[model samples]
Target: MADFSPPDDNKRTGQRGAEKSGRVADFRYRPPSQSKPQKCGTGSSAKKRGGGKTSIPSPKPQGSAPSHHHRKQAYAALDLGTNNCRLLIARPSGENFTVIDAFSRVVKLGEGLAMSGKLSDDAMDRTLGALKVCAEKLRRRNVHLARSVATEACRRAANGPAFIEHVREETGIVLDIISAEEEARLAVLGCHILLEGGEGPAVIFDIGGGSTELILVEPGGKVPRILDWQSVPWGVVSLTDTVGRCTGSRDERLARYADMRRVVSESFAPFAERIAPRAECEEEIRLLGTSGTVTTLASLHLELPHYDRREVDGLIVRSQAMRDISERLSGMSLEERSQLPCIGNDRADLVVAGCAILDSILDIWPSERLGVADRGIREGILRSLMAADAEGERHRREIRGA
Candidate 1:
């Protein structure tokens, strides 16, 4: 009932990579240092440079081993979102980092947050237990530098800070409550490589448990520069909590699904309006989504017996197919949806909300295809950490030469 599953043990084969132009190749993670990166802050905010562009230096990807001096340095990134707790541990490879350990669990940390405006005790307990496991992994892996972040749920909860301090006291892991802007930037940094190659600006989104982030980026550098972004307080968990799951007649469920769409659309109105004028003129609109919602839907689109990141991540599905699947999932009853593979009892109830959110996204930015990315904030953090370390190493070399 806790919704906790064992760690993945790197079974996913995190074959993520990036190109010099910030596009995907054989699933890699290209470090931001490969390009001239402007100085930017980390932990709580995104790095914004001149020309109204937000820079999220791509983190180092996982690849070949580094020199002997760099072999011992292991970095970790933990993303504790509203619905899940995920951790990634890796070491800097030649130009990227190789994943050594990873863990993901559906803890639903924001289970009752919408109604209570606070993190419920049960949810906190569940998350803490999962974090304990993450702490153990970090210890066993001997992670040299680690950054753990708590997103929307923690940011919205009144007792979020208290819970964060408690987590440090209990697990010795410091969790930074990052801004929605930073969250959006990090999500893009993690998965932008998967975006379909194109000329015009693209939209990358992360549908979290408590909040959904949509970012518009102009891609031409090592990392795409954010043109505009918005974080709506309507993710799978929050939206589901606000809109009852209409478990009655099929018509009733469809109506509620419409209601969910309406709410999300209105919330996204400002963002939609801002991008419409610019996006409408572009020859082709490129859209990429990184979150459980997109991944789950991608899995269903593939008709796989179970979830597989290798296939889902960096995959593209027809926008119309995604829309049709979202509508279908929205109409299904909780039990009916639960029976479907890739969306069992765990995601049955909340998947509908996700569908609604995705529907709204497709409506605003109508694209021929939607790119799916299983990697996000955690991978972004890993890249940033490795880039910083590489920079520090360069500084040491310069001092030694001087």
Candidate 2:
């Protein structure tokens, strides 16, 4: 089995100004535009910047349209990650953008990639099905300019390229397999705005399905300057699948959880060394997390009856509280974890590994509080495309003036 079910579409509802939906929201700030963006140096790579388009008609949320111009200029971003497939459609509104329609589904694309070193057939089918839904949503929304991406799972899979072609042929959507560096960058682009006001260096991380990215950034820059990044080969899906089953008493389960943490902690040692000097003057430093593990944990921390993106995003929970939750969760059996509100049966087995990973991260960088963000690669991709669009518009205006 693929480990996840079909997602219930989060329909936009009645709200006057800037309302947020489930697992998606209107961010408080947009990433500052880059004065100069380093190019990938190849023509093929250059063309990937906002290169695809496929738009169709779709439903809209209740409320007055922000602007006719906003509707006329629509952009879309699709992110097929190791565990979840997500889509975001938005239009420029003032300095930022408003999400018009969005979709997210857990496909568990890397369910067994850790040991197998390849995407399983069931996982591929699940992912492709979710992508098809994204295609339809994009079409219905008439998304003109769009960028679709696949992350760690596709990068390491044996038949990743073939699967990309298959997705295109079947869903009329193209998926770009991005590098680890780009993946970390996009994640930062999408989520860095969630960082609380601080001048000290920051650590932003995304705990994914097959890998976890730990990025060190120097704050106070337009887009936080990515000083260094490390992609550890341990995500929730890969970690859980590799950790074996937890079928014993609470002590045994906690021991297994501890083992997972040890493995992740060892992986962080090298990264920790590189940043050891920076840890000296840690005043005003911040730690922000973007991933299912963090968000799910945030929901658990809040004890929300169901997941709420608006409430969770930008939320600050104390480090001790997060640890408490992880500790409490580790003591529970898989069945107990599955009964959790946001976790359910589909995510029950996977959440423990996630908690373990989170524990390891806290061990490395002990911040007072962790910022939660429901946004990531998709949000990052949208910012890139919209920024490119704004630049193109300026260029055209200059040409006309001349």
Candidate 3:
């Protein structure tokens, strides 16, 4: 594994902030772009849109037996969300998957969409650029089967279908606009690997750029029974836009955080009620959090002065440590936060809002320790594809034997 360091600079000039703000503002009211029609589902079209060459270089030859034989073939998954676009290419190794290639960029695909009910041109362009890179990587890896999904932003946007059409036309990547229920299910599937040989009921929460998903499960089952789940619209970006404008004193910011927490708690009330019926009798309830917010917090708790996925992933953080980290972050200005190795200029301002949302979720659930998960939707998609492939292989073998 390679060492990961935070970006060197965190200071954003007022001008830069204004520029980003302007982009956001433009997305809020601008009309969709009128471009040439795209041909859907052709491999050649995808290759052209992604660029002439592949994004990831081919793997080097090994001295002995080919690792490709011992290890299962590579599988790919892409998740395009309201705030970020990400790709993961991996192969199954026994019970878990080893990542062969991965890419992620924050594009804010849903930026200002809440107000306009449509994806802004600037946001669409940024998202498309990220997808192009992902497509190239997939091609380079020679990934035979993969699934790409788009969440909240596309689901909410009035022009989302057009946007999807454009993506197929340009990238040849069909973006499945997943429903909230499906989103929750995929999150649980990705986190299931973490539950192996563990005890008690577990609660999984995934906080994304646009929405938050919560799931409750009990032991004694191969798959965790979904006791209850909820998808809350309040996320880091949305909350920050609401709470960032009310800055005054430290006390005021604290009050604002409290207000944000109240709102999240209220949104989670129905789910809370559904779980409360069984939660009391269940022994040893555990909390698991999957998203950038939790991972960033884990990095800060380690005080590494850099972000290393290996160290942060699957680590456990105590409630007090989480609280301390949140307080430290709240005290720092956006520029100061940008300087932190775990948080860079891209996430400085938005991270505080994420922290607030996580804190609220913690208060509602009140678990002592939280299991941090770097994997989420992409992993879930890969697992589903792999399972289908395995089943197909089994059927073929059975037919041959017969």
True-structure RMSD, every candidate: 11.8, 13.0, 13.3
- Candidate 1 segments whose C-alpha is farther than 4 A from its true place: 1-67
Pick by TM-score: which candidate is best? 1
Q: What lDDT score belongs to each candidate, Candidate 1 first?
A: 0.77, 0.72, 0.68
Across 239-289, the per-residue lDDT of candidate 2 in tens digits comes to 777776555998888778877887778777788877777666748667899
Candidate 3 lDDT over residue span 81-163, tens digit each: 88899998887665556778999999988777656667888888888888888877877887767788888778777788888
Report the Cα lDDT for residue 394, model 1. Answer: 65
- Which scores better on lDDT, 2 or 3? 2
Q: Candidate 3 has what TM-score? A: 0.80
Overlapping backbone residue pairs in candidate 2 total 4
lDDT of 1 at 121: 78
lDDT of 2: 0.72
By lDDT, the best candidate is 1
| Per-residue lDDT over 110-218 for candidate 1, one digit per residue giving the tens place of the 0 to 100 score | 8988887788877888888899899889888877888888898888887889888777766678888887777876788788888888896688999999888888888
When 1 and 2 are scored with TM-score, the better candidate is 1
In terms of lDDT, model 3 sits at 0.68
lDDT of 2 at 128: 78
Look at candidate 1 and tell me the lDDT of residue 376: 85
Residue 165 of candidate 2: its Cα lDDT? 68
